[model samples]
Target: MSDTHAPTTRLNKRMAELGLCSRREADEWIARGWVRVDGRVAGIGVQVAPGARIDIDPAARGHQQEQVTILLHKPVGYVSGQAEDGYQPAAALVQARSHWRGDASRQRFSPGQLRGLAPAGRLDIDSTGLLVLTQDGRVARRLIGEDSTVEKEYLVRVAWGEATVGVQPLVPPAALAKLRHGLSLDGRPLKPARVDWQNPEQLRFVLTEGRKRQIRRMCELVGLKVMGLKRVRIGAVTLGQLPLGQWRYLGPDERF
Candidate 1:
């Protein structure tokens, strides 16, 4: 059987404004037969009147739609979200002229009144770099949520491995330098890390995996302990010229 009755206005828009759910949510409810107009099962995308009655099941409004997104130039030691019994949350640092001091718009920072908005991805307390926080459910799902494909890039200062280990007395330093240049301690010869030697003292490490203290652990494995590690970029967004301990809004299309 098909619905022959028609409503005066769009079911989705009316339901959204009336029930405070977003348009996308209203559509989902209609498709699942969870929304009713005048006690009749509403069809998806149907028009309904503003004065007409609209109903929605409470469960359909997932909190994801209302989430807020924030990007922070986190300094070391701050936790990404909720404070532990002792630590402070990273969101506390979202301030004006502090994080985005040099940004073009020169907007002012104010407290976000929305509750439940939180960090989407985590940078360890010991590490300082770019951190993203969100109130949007989709952003959370895209970042820390399972199946995230975003890439995080970091800058690291490491010991020069070429001079440390390789051929010994029997072999000349030239041969040892050549042999050591490509070798790494990661079980299989490490995949060619996108490395750019900044100087004799530093090397850049760009990686895709987000393991626990991954960069530090990887550096330890290669015999060069990390002197410093700072995340400079994530996906296409860079922590360029942004000051530390501050945050700003992530514009649309700024995906990692």
Candidate 2:
């Protein structure tokens, strides 16, 4: 029996895998007659062999360049996505008036910029600090895709608690060590995390994965209750001095 297989893939998936653009972006380009395969404009749902050459029109490239990423200093009480339980999404805070005046990026705020913008990663409603929102699908995939490894840093304030039997008031060194490498949640072992003390009452956590309420749940296992949690950084970007409830453009030179 032969082990060989066809060397072709969907054009949109190929483009996304190549980091050129996302599948949706590729579809948009295809609809606009802006994508070419082997020097001919490709149609939607087109598939190409591995050796096929793909090119994007300059117009599509320019339009992609105009897509924006935003860094928001999300305040507690806003959901990361659509409104839930009567709380508005963090995206609601991204109006012209909410744009940070100190933003170094010269792109002026416009209502059009908000169209199709969505959160790349989630920040819990009870948590506060840096939350990323973007109109670029490539950015979204890079930050939250299944294979994404970007680090998200948080400062979590905790209190000693007596909730679980046999748990201590002060987290022991052994438990802290477990937090760094030996913890499981939802029946799966969590990825190794960087956990350490930022202050007596706070823990600094650097995790490459974002599970729902992960930090709070992790602390619970070690006999601590999270009193407050704030995300401060994602990848190479930091919250910096961006005021709470304000947002700013991700500058041209900035990369994840």
Candidate 3:
């Protein structure tokens, strides 16, 4: 944010416009001395206006800007964001063959969007379901960009070889089966998840961010092993029976 009353703007406002962080968060960081401007520690009262060179810490910058923003019903074995050891990028699944239209004007897929397209977030190669690819900067910035707080939902199927001679875990075996739950993979203690059962062997997952093998890891913590994983939603958008390995542009009314 830039300074005010001194021909500059408040620091928090500047940070928000640059997509560095939310103004509220910037204020907190400034108070905590975590932000600097031009090598000088920034205070909450500091002012900066547009075009001033700002240096936010690298971790604070976060990966940003989805180029295409297409959502795919990813099939297992297609990696979400990267082309990893013998794994193809889930992004590769997007082709002209998959475009569907409710509004013809928006149906025009630009080659520029295609050539510049890539996944803003990830879905591991072994996991499947709703994966988003994007070219829209706002969606990318909001969903995969560093300051993103979008929620993702999934359905997980799990199996266990044995129970510890105890009744069952409080985490719930029934709830773990085809149920909804939350996850965190940054090694921070996870946010509370809403877990429930859809059947006996499946658990639904809703996460705010993607961490490496988060659902699988969470299942392990509960003594269950993941047999299958599928993301069903992201934000308010749903996969809605879209076939695996197929993709479609998000609808205008969709709220992801």
Candidate 4:
């Protein structure tokens, strides 16, 4: 008989919660006998207590090491994730010829790398700048997971009121203050952001959260209209001098 009152969770879910790997990968590892619980080989569908010791085999580590993460200087008009409404997904540009000539990683482009490549976060079709696509589940969870605290920085060009051309407009002090701290989107209060003017027409926005069209909606609420938006940095990685529409592998030494 089992002690039904004890708390338990699926092994895969516990591994994911501990940042070991995604649930799918955990299942595969368990099937291959690459995952162990309390020094015993764990099987698929196993349930584990909170204090169970979990370990992964060396083969699993090597498999994870081979997974690639790519950084792209996304151009406007490309959807960040999947193709929709006839717009191409940013992943479509990860071909051999499109690899940045300035890439120093020396990683050869391979079609096999595209097998499971997916964007970690989103950049709207109309926005441009740094975009991350990866085959590694760990990297994906690190950047887009619910508890991620990575900072994404953007340059936003905006126009006050209705005029977009030949007009220099300043953001009202009150509106700018609200932009930095107080605001709500989709009926929930937003986390504080680091927003300030980069120039007369552009604002620098550093946010830790990526809600759909969050910046654009936030600007609209403050009476400013976004004319252009470009993500310049995510975590410690910047778009750098990578030309538009080109990509490079995230170097082994790089983190987040």
Give the winner by lDDT: 4
Flag the better candidate by TM-score, 2 or 3. 2
How many residue pairs clash (N, CA or C atoms closer than 3 angstroms) in each of the candidate models, in the order given?
A: 12, 0, 29, 0
Q: Over 4 Å off in model 3, which ranges?
A: 1-47, 50-68, 100-106, 162-187
Q: Per TM-score, what order, best first?
A: 4, 2, 3, 1
Cα lDDT, model 1, residue 194 = 57
- Checking candidate 2 for backbone clashes, the offending pairs are none
Best by TM-score: 4
Task: Report the lDDT tens digits of candidate 4 across residue range 40-107.
Answer: 99988999888888989999999888889999999999999889999999999999999999999978
Decide which is better by lDDT, 1 or 4. Answer: 4
lDDT of 2 by residue, 1-256 (tens): 2112666789999999888888888898999999999889999888787777888899998999889999999999999999988999999999988899999999998888888899999999999999999989999999998899999999988877643333333678987888898889999999999998886778899999999899999988877888899999999999999999999999989888
RMSD of each: 10.2, 3.5, 9.3, 2.2
Q: Model 2 — which ten-residue stretch has the worst lDDT?
A: 161-170
Candidate 1, residues 1-256, lDDT tens digits: the string is 2244644667776654453555665676688888877779889878776566676665555433334567788887788778886878887776554556555543344555235567767787877888887655555555664455666777766544455322123233543232224544445343334555555555566655466666666655445556667888877888887778866667655666
Structural similarity to truth (TM-score) of each candidate:
0.59, 0.93, 0.67, 0.94
Model 3 Cα shift for residue 181 (angstroms): 9.4
Evaluated at residue 37, the lDDT of candidate 4 is: 89
lDDT score, candidate 1, position 152: 72
Q: Give the lDDT of residue 167 in candidate 3.
A: 22
TM value for model 2: 0.93
lDDT of 2: 0.89
On a 0 to 1 TM-score scale, where does candidate 1 land against the true structure? 0.59
Candidate 4 global CA lDDT score:
0.91
